[model samples]
Target: MVDLQVQYQQLKGEIDRALAAVLDTSHYILGPQGQAFEAEAAAYLGVKHAVAVASGTDALHLALRAAGLGPGDEVITSPFTFIATAEAIAYVGATPVFVDIDPQTFNIDPELARKAITARTRAILPVHLFGQPADLAPLQAMCDEHGLLLIEDCAQSFGATYAGRQTGSWGALGCFSFFPSKNLGCYGDGGMVVTGDDRLAEQLRMLRNHGSKVRYHHDIIGYNSRLDEMQAAILNVKLRHIDRFNQLRRQNAHYYSERLADAGVVPPREDGKGVHVYHQYTLLTDRREAVQQALTTAGCASAIYYPIPLHRQNVFAAAFGGVSLPVSESVAARCLSLPIFPELNQEQMDRVVAAVRGA
Candidate 1:
């Protein structure tokens, strides 16, 4: 789905130098690189603080903990997202209230989410699926009216913006991932949580480091979730070129949309409320299996972001088996993501378009 090898070659010198510096210093944990990356990321996202974590899942898990969500609390989120979105709530002994997604944008429906809110609902966690920012205005207003926390799962969106503000800066706490395939990813597993609240930032910092502010003294139970120095160093180098990377993705996506306009598929729609970084150039087609087969025959790649909604998954089936979310189910059955990256050339895009049209 991506060409990491080519990207690495493009930044070989800088990445190698960053790695060498980290190795020479021998400060793998809580090192200068990680600290610097956190500050740089915070500045880029226009947030007050950013805490690096081991993985994107850890970022979400720790954010829920820092927000004081527990047993009886419920977090409203979309069922169309990756499993980790709901898993984080479950990790903190909180309930995940699954809701349907908007048909066009494929993000959590704000009206559905508001309807799902109950007395037990303590937070609304919105996922920016496929680097498209969710409609946060209504969701934020609903949260404010109910005095609920607003957390964002920005795992797929690194530099995406909504209403002229960055996605990670919209909510109380925003979580990001560096899973190598993301718009702004590192060499390996890395994640961050950005927030404007000072109290949440301190809690996240302590929670990531064994709940100790004074090194030895422990304040509460915490997990080992710090982002390693090597990964952080790699991220620092990549972060410098994130804007150009996103621009390329947007350009490539627009080209694909134009080519596929009459190719018997529904191109992704941008709501105009935000910038979509095109983490994946996904489209909806009734003939998904045939298109996938054609791409495979043409030596091109295509994937399904999610084949099953969260509420329908076996893990949550017992509790939510009877729940029905028609939109999520319908979209999951038809969505197919084509290969999209900053390095994608015209020849590659033409080949992909031809395969889809031929199918």
Candidate 2:
């Protein structure tokens, strides 16, 4: 649903030079490229620290580990997100409490999350789905009241903001993914964890490596989840153009919303609390299958972000089979994401809109 090749062609000169520099130095892992990217990303996100990791999943995993989450802990999160969100909590021997989402924003409903809280609840992990920032104000207050951690799953919201602050900077720790299709992705798998706390930052740095502050002395068991230098170099080049890229995506999304206003579909909604980066310009329609078929016939790409909620997935069915989250289930049945990217031209967007309208 993205045009990575076109974007590469547009930035070929800068990306090629960045890669060449890394190759010249032959520093493939935990080198200058990664260090520099972390610093640049931190500054851009307005966070005190950024720790690079192998994948977005690792970022979440390491963040949870650094936060001292373990067995018997419960992490409340939206069920309408990617499997990785819940998987990260499971990796740390914690239970992921499935919660419903807001109909418009498609983020975890703050009230529903608060209702799910229990004595075992250790954190609230909210996903900023489709580059739209969640309602962090209430969630943050709830965390503070409950003495819980607020970790953001910002895999789809690299440049999105909430209430004039960046998404990753809102919570205690923010996790981002650099998957190729993401808003600010790298050449391959890469991720980052950002935090304002000095202690959490240090713990994250150790957790991503072999849990070593020094060269050979390992403090705690850690994973080999370092972001490679090659990927970091690519991200560094892309980072320089992130604001422009996000702006273009936002413009395209607005265009789609305006064009699809009367197409019997629900266009993505921006709550005005923050800027939406439109990683995926998703719409909700009762005729999802027909619309998808029409797009395929017209040679246009469309996808379902999540066809089934995490609570309904096979892995968690036994544990949450009786639990009912009507909103998440209803949205999953109708959500259809159209092609969205900074490089998408007018013709492409027009073609997509025409297909949906014709359907």
Candidate 3:
């Protein structure tokens, strides 16, 4: 799904220097490097605060915490996403109301989400799946009308923009992951929560650090989820080149879309509202098994984002046994991600397309 080694090699000098700096300081926790990255990230996203955390899961968990979600509350979201999106809700003792996704965008359907809301619904957590922003305006309006919060899972959309604004700036709180495969990844695990609300920002900071504004003085129950300084330093270096990287990804996406159309593979459709950063360049194919086998035989790699919907997962079977999300299930069966790293060459892309067509 990604070529992190090639990406790293492109920035070896900067990355090495950043790592050396972190080692010199010997401050690996919430040190100056992490603090600086937070500020830069906030500014880039047009948010007032960006709280760095240990992982994207932590960012989602803490964002829900900052939004005042708790036991028995429900967070309506798409069932066709990474487990972390729903897992964070479960971690906070909140029920995840799985809704069917829009088959075209592969994002939570606003109509379905609005229909799923109940008196227990406290928030709407929407994942910007495949680096395209969900239909956020309608979802945001829904949240506003129902007095619910809006949190964006932007783990795959670091530099993506929606309706002239960056994705993280649209929702009340936006969570991002710095996993090595993401658009703007660090060396290891790291994540961030961006928000414009001062109150929410302060709450997030406290919640990420044992609920203490001052060291060791616990005010509320919280988790130890601070971002590593070394990761932060590396992210800072990579952040400087994200625009160029994403531009290359966009170019590759356009090329693939054109070629894949000829191969009978349905390429991802741009919703036309935001910049689609082409995070994974996923395709929907009914012949997944055949296509995957063909690609493997040709020494090309392909992946399925989610082979099973959240509602069908064994862990949540008791709560969602009767739930029927046909679209989510359909998408889970058909969705296949191909090689979309920014560094992939034209020859590599051509080979992948040829393999899929051959299958």
TM-score to true structure, per model: 0.99, 0.99, 0.98
Whole-model alpha-carbon lDDT for candidate 3: 0.92
lDDT of 1 by residue, 197-242 (tens): 9999999999999998888999989889999999999999999999
- Candidate 3 wrong stretches, greater than 4 Å: none
Q: Candidate 3: TM-score?
A: 0.98
Q: Write the per-residue lDDT of candidate 2 for residues 98-203, one digit (tens) a residue.
A: 9899999999999999999999999999999999999999999999999999999999999898988999998999999999999889988999999999999999
Span of ten consecutive residues with least summed lDDT in model 2: 204-213
Candidate 3, residues 76-129: lDDT per residue as tens digits?
988988999999999889999998999899999999999998999999999999
After superposing candidate 2, which stretches have Cα over 4 Å from the reference? none
C-alpha lDDT of residue 15 in model 1: 97
Give all candidates' CA lDDT scores.
0.96, 0.94, 0.92
| Native-to-model Cα distance after best TM-score fit, residue 230 in candidate 3, in Å | 0.5
Which predicted model would earn the best lDDT?
A: 1
